[model samples]
Target: MNPRDTEEMTATMKRELLCVLLLCGAVFTLPGQEIHRRFRRGARSSRVTCRDEKTQMIYRQHESWLRPMLRSNRVEYCWCNSGRSQCHSVPVKNARATCYKDLGVTYRGTWSTAESGAECINWNSSLLARKSYNGRRPDASKLGLGNHNYCRNPDKDSKPWCYVFKAGKYVPEFCSTPVCSQEKNGDCYFGKGLAYRGTHSLTVSGTSCLQWNSMVLIGKINTAWKTNAQTLGLGKHNYCRNPDGDAKPWCHVLKDRKLTWEYCDIPQCSTCGLRQYKRPQFRIKGGLFSDITSHPWQAAIFVQNRRSPGERFLCGGILISSCWVLSAAHCFLERYPPHHLKVVLGRTYRVEPGVEEQKFEVEKYIVHKEFDEDTYNNDIALLQLKSDSPQCVQETGSVRTVCLPEADLQLPDWTECGAFWLRQARGVYNAPSLSFLTASPFYSERLKEAHVRLYPSNRCTSQYLLNKTVTSNMLCAGDTRSGGNQANLHDACQVNMSVSPYSEPTPG
Candidate 1:
């Protein structure tokens, strides 16, 4: 009995020893820190003082040799546990740091006290950096600022420094300075808490700034554009570069010398005084007609006696169909009347000064049923020409019939949508002899303007529709996501509009 039991015990002992040796090798040779390194190193070899002023800490000085305990190039965590008299290491030039009192130190990833019996930490540096142990990207969490990029490096090329933050799995959102001296080509921007194309002046409040290039605007200010002095408004107070701790705020100077303050203080108000142009409210010089004649479906409506027709204003019409004659609706308003109405069939507004004008006569000028006498909703009317002149498709080069749509269609909702309008260059149609350049149609905004009122279905619905059925009959267009002005002079030719039917049209 004694021999058998001794042999069995000996065999078991050998197996246990082998198991211990294998386990030790596996723990020491892995990719991460060896088990021996789990305890703290009495002191680190070097120090790295955070240099950037924007860094959160108060000039934190850290151990450089802490790199080995940390996965090099990876983030490592460390903690401050309110140890009043912990010792720290200070680095000397070209030499590893020696321990000193009142500074913190960790040995093999664990915190220790110079005196005996300090509690081990749960949130020691290593544990803090390794909270979500799935080996994923660190969560650079922030409060108030929903998700944004937390940048490790800054870009040199961009103005108004920005931080790159990880928005989501590989996405990033940058938080940049909004006060820009000039707009950058593709950079996104926000001002007064509104986003817009980095290049355009932001005039709308709470309006998200958009992206777009800039162009010098040349034209007399329409009376409508005149600033209201009493309503002058203030912008933001931007910090000046001067060290006196002063801030300069921009305020919009309104017409008539009055001021309004919303976000900041109004600095100055001076009249531009540019209200003296004598040309018609809207007119074409002569060049926009070339392409107009090329479109088989296009029709031109000319208004006669735009200013002072006898007893009433007269307007000419182009028979788009038996159901429609394209004429200016303004021609038949109560303020203008239609007693002097006339329809000029073949047209030549320009002639050798003395030659008689070309044309046709109107039996009646039927203005649009919903046309507003004051606002001119549908700027068109039908002139029943004397004895329906033949639908001359040939004389009218491109005589394609324009189809109409129902007015109640629903449009999508948006913070804002752009509108564009186009007018051809002068002489582009009839007399190629003159400049054929036509200016763009006035970029008129709906609802947001001082004149246009929002429709109930359009504004009062459960949601707002930008191109709803009400806009079906109206030519509607918009800006690209870039936020550029769709009505700028260069893009003016691309503007298009449609006629929309409204159930409750504005009363005439």
Candidate 2:
């Protein structure tokens, strides 16, 4: 009973082992079939033409595997190099087929069918034919052909060539005119898309157009001429128009690669009208006599006396321009007529006349419009002189014009300035008839100048003027030194004479 059971069990185990081996073999064969299917599909999709005998024989070995995948009913094969046929066979690709139909007649049989199979039939024979013809003819006959014509056939052959009749030669085709054309009028044309159209002149180069932003200066042109503002394509707000005739010529500026007319005059220095003469380096402190040339712009103003017919010295002035004199407006307290006033320049002595002294009559007097009599605010006045020539006092070593301070000029507090004037003093003398009689003050008779420092506005307020309105325009000057008796005080008591009866008088 044990032997029979062992034999049956061995047979069943053999059968089970054989079934497992067969299942493993089937699993491996499925992948091989899938691989074969993929290879056949690829071969059928690509139209590979094999012209060489060796290549044809190799392809035949693979045909059987690929034939089942082919869907086309009719198929012809030819050797193709870069999509063009290498043999005498026609191209099957749609693009190459069309190209053969258009230009094949020109280069037919010119190429070998199968010498080395390296050169193929160029289906685009029209391009090859045009290139061949172009090399044989003069460049003038092909001027109309664009640069791209080298790779493709031009649409038409009879297009006009860019030939110059006078030069008897052809030029290359251009997108626009290379040179500017002068019109019947003064305007000119400098190619298309350039804002320089209608310009008087233009500059350019062979390879490129003129830079549209380049600037051209036409000097000293009358600004009255109508400007070509619109043609330049500049906005109106970008420039200023000078209607005043005294303004300088305008300049044309290039903006945004376009010409823009604008005001080009450089701002003149405020010191331009100032005399260039160097000031005397040797300066003196305290009250001292000044040379006539040292203060050439100094002036002595005289007014006709109402009681006496003779003129009387009134005040001092400064010559600021060729025909204008600046002085304290309060000097005209009597409201004297302009004809009654006279200006004496280059005078060193108060009474005696100087050699370089020039006299001038006043044509007009203009006190500051905002002058205040009580506070002496805006005490300046301009006197226009009456003269035969345009200039009143000829500029000389002793009669040059002085520079007027700018309106915004500021000097630090305590800045020393020379104050020129004539000083007078009186000495009491004992007499028999009177207890003490005072003689008329002895006039200095010479131009004396004193160094005075400017006082800060805060220190020169209404409080110092006894509650008087000390306006902003009013300026205060005083001696900067303290606690010292002024030996030769000049005009120190001019404002304090009311407080002290014995104060010295100052006349300027």
| Candidate number achieving the greatest TM-score relative to the actual structure | 2
Cand. 1 TM to true fold: 0.25
- Models 1 onward score TM values of 0.25, 0.37
* Residue 228 local lDDT, model 1: 23
Shift of residue 351 alpha carbon in model 1, Å:
5.5
Candidate 2 lDDT tens digits, 1-508: 6998999999999999989988887898788897777657547534444334424433311121111114544233323343333322222222111011232321111211211212222322333334433322223122212112221222332221121112342222211111112333213221121322222221211121222232242332422222422222222222222223323223344567665454332221121122323333343333455556766777788888888779877777767676787666667767889899999987777778888889999988877666666655555667888876543566666676666554456778656565533221111101000000011244446654445555566766656655655455445555546523331223342111100111111211
Give candidate 1's error at residue 13 in angstroms: 99
Candidate 2 accuracy as TM-score: 0.37
RMSD of 2: 30.1
Worst 10 contiguous positions by lDDT, candidate 1: 444-453
